[model samples]
Target: MPAQVLAPAPAVTPPRAGRGYWRRLLPALAVLACLTRVPSFTRPLWNPDEGYLAVQARILAHGGQLYETVVDRKPPLVPWLYEAAFAVTGSGSLTSVRVLAVLAQLLTAALLAALARRRWGDRAGRTAGVLYLLVSVGLNPEDAQAAGFEVFILPGTAAAMWCADRRRWTAAGVAVGCAVLAKQTGGAVLLPVLWLCVTSGAARTAAPRLAAGAALPVLGAALLTDPAGFLFWTVTGSTAYAAFSGSPLHALTRALGNAGLLAAACAGLLAAVARAPRAASADLWLWLAASAGAVLTGFHFFGHYYLQLLPPLALLATAALHTEPWARHRTAVLVSACACAVFLTWGLTAPRAELTHAQRVAEAAARRTGPRDPVLIWGMHPETYWLARRAPASRYLTAGLLTNYSGGRDGARVGERYAVDGAWPVFRREMTARAPALIVDDSRGKPYAPAHVPTLRRLLTDRYRVVGTVDGAVLYARVS
Candidate 1:
């Protein structure tokens, strides 16, 4: 046969790589949205911390100050986030708060999936996303329902890891700084970040970039607002938090209670080390260790605290799962099945009683007080203040913030310092100055009761009378 000239195969264009990434990410995001979004709406704001955050954000949005008008033992970033959310969607809407929270979690999952895929492979990445969604939504009932600090910082941590893996040192540093702004514990991300910069052949160039990036957000926070207040709350105020929350032993007990999570975390780290030495290096393991320390330092050991561990654990677990001899397809199938099963378990066990009661209380509070009025709540339900659209009668939105619990169970020496005898008169003075339209006694004879704020107790008895009751909380209207 005569040799024939054949036209070169038409230059084939590889479909843009980004399109493939989105194609995979969109479906996963849809699944995560289904797992988190709608369910958040059905749940009520029962967490005191969530309430504190929502109300504080509203205060900041309304031209008031953080740490001055509203005090919390957390960094300013979280409230700033809530402030932005409230600004976009009216401050009065709890749905807005829930939406903000769900969006944060979903973003974390996306970043986590991207990082996993980048470090390992496509299948590993997909597994990481599913695992994160499952564990996040399946957080223990006591701490899972309302958005917490962990949720806000998770995406930032994941983004830092992803950027570091790509050798984008400055961006990764910025991510770490943002995470710290969300919660002081996020500072732990720096260890692994430094590890990456040091290990990367170009340590001199990378380290300085990383440090420069990290300083921008923090410096901005200091220059733009109350540096003194920020220092006090994030640094000084937080010094006493762990002591007041509980002991290290209590945190250990909580960790033991969630043995499955711990097992998975260990498995992933060990598996990656065995199968993918370069991928799971000492620096990465150090990141995991640092993350664990961050979680334990709080000592409170709330279920939400473990959310901080999800990124490293998910990465390790996915790598570990990949090491199995089973076919990749089979391994993926197993991961999907487990995620679905745990998700179902969470669905079945979730309670509705709190939801129903919260609705009733919110409705009652809204009816009794105007949006501009001040409301005094004796116990620690800041959600009611958010729902009522009322300013707190005092900066001590929760009595615990101003009450001395030194001799009590979760005792700490600093309680006397912060909640000094001087605090009671201030609390009484503020309540009198505010002249709240409605006083909510949430105690129902709990330990944080009339005795906790005797002055407020007397004021409530002398100037207000019981008007109605909802979910064990008594509402007292000022006698006109």
Candidate 2:
């Protein structure tokens, strides 16, 4: 017989090359997300934002109304999300909320991967997922790792973009609405979603569906909360809160500095995108612009605000990297790694004494009061309420409302000039109605010291006596 000639075996592609591979790899990616944030699990509080949300959530879980009984300027969903997490993991478990934040981070990575895979290829998808997992927590671990509003909003905003890419108009709108419920800046996602619709000439068909879908969550939230209070805190009052009362020169310098730092941290990814044959798509450009607007909204330029920029940037960067040569790809990777190392090292090693001090004050306050006894913190450390597991004596979690000290500006110069006249009466009524059993003054003098306010000074002098001082916080117990 003639030598049998076997045809060259067809190129065998590994299972990972298949379309279903990304879906199968999702679980592993989710695990990566959790692993990256493990440090968050050890700390009870990473930021004051978490402390405020935790305290408000506890109040909500205990049948207190949102804006009425417990006050915060954020939208209602985050507190409710925290309440749900508490229900599952037991009340006051900061660890559980951190877990919830990890889950959100995982979902966002998955969505970004799926979107990239649909648009480019499997490699791009995997790169996007891994890049997001690394960079999201790389900027400032203290803020990024916390179960803050920024962490929670990413999943919703990313989902909206994924749905929009698929032309699922109604679902995309619903996702945007949910994102807004997490934070007002989240609504910035809607601009890109609408841009997609208009660019595709589907505005007529998609716009109405998008509107209807977006209304579901907003209307639902309104029904569940005090409508007037919800509007005031989330919308009306936010006007004043968002205003830039600080010096224009200072604002400009800070904006440039923060923006530069963020750009430097993502230098590799930005370079890859710039070098790609096909630059970012119009919708993505709009998405980046919208997210940038969101970050600059309050002119505060906080570290975590930069998080809103990551999803779109990750997608753009990974998609661009897919077509780059190996040498260039290696260079991009090296730059990004160095940047991440610097930021992560600084964030992880930064002193946590302030948090430790807050914990000590809470412990001191707890020793002097019962679990149900209401306690008031004269300073801005709402974490004390959550740590001590005591109800707040007043709805004002921080003295910002009373002192008119905007977190966005120099608290000293802007003090009292912008103080809400209406808040003082409400504070007096609530404090008089149910006096706190303990008062923890963590003000450390100057801005929010009770001595600065005659009313607060008299109340402290007449009703309470200093029992102890821990760190810088003074604990006063009610005289029997």
Best by TM-score: 2
Q: How much is 279 displaced in model 2, in angstroms?
A: 7.2
What is the per-residue lDDT of model 1 for residues 92-198, given as tens digits with 9 covering 90 to 100? Answer: 65677677777787788888777766655666667777766655654554455466787788888888877887789999999998998888888888998777776
The Cα local distance difference test for each model comes to: 0.68, 0.79
Lowest summed lDDT window (length 10), candidate 2: 1-10
TM-score for each model: 0.82, 0.90
What is the C-alpha lDDT profile of model 2 across 346-388, one tens digit per residue? 6667678868888888888889899889999988778888888
RMSD value for candidate 2: 7.4
Model 2 segments beyond 4 Å from truth?
1-19, 247-261, 276-280, 341-348, 411-417
* Model 1: per-residue Cα lDDT at residue 314: 63
TM-score of 1: 0.82
Q: After superposition, how far is residue 247 of candidate 1 from its true place, in Å?
A: 6.8
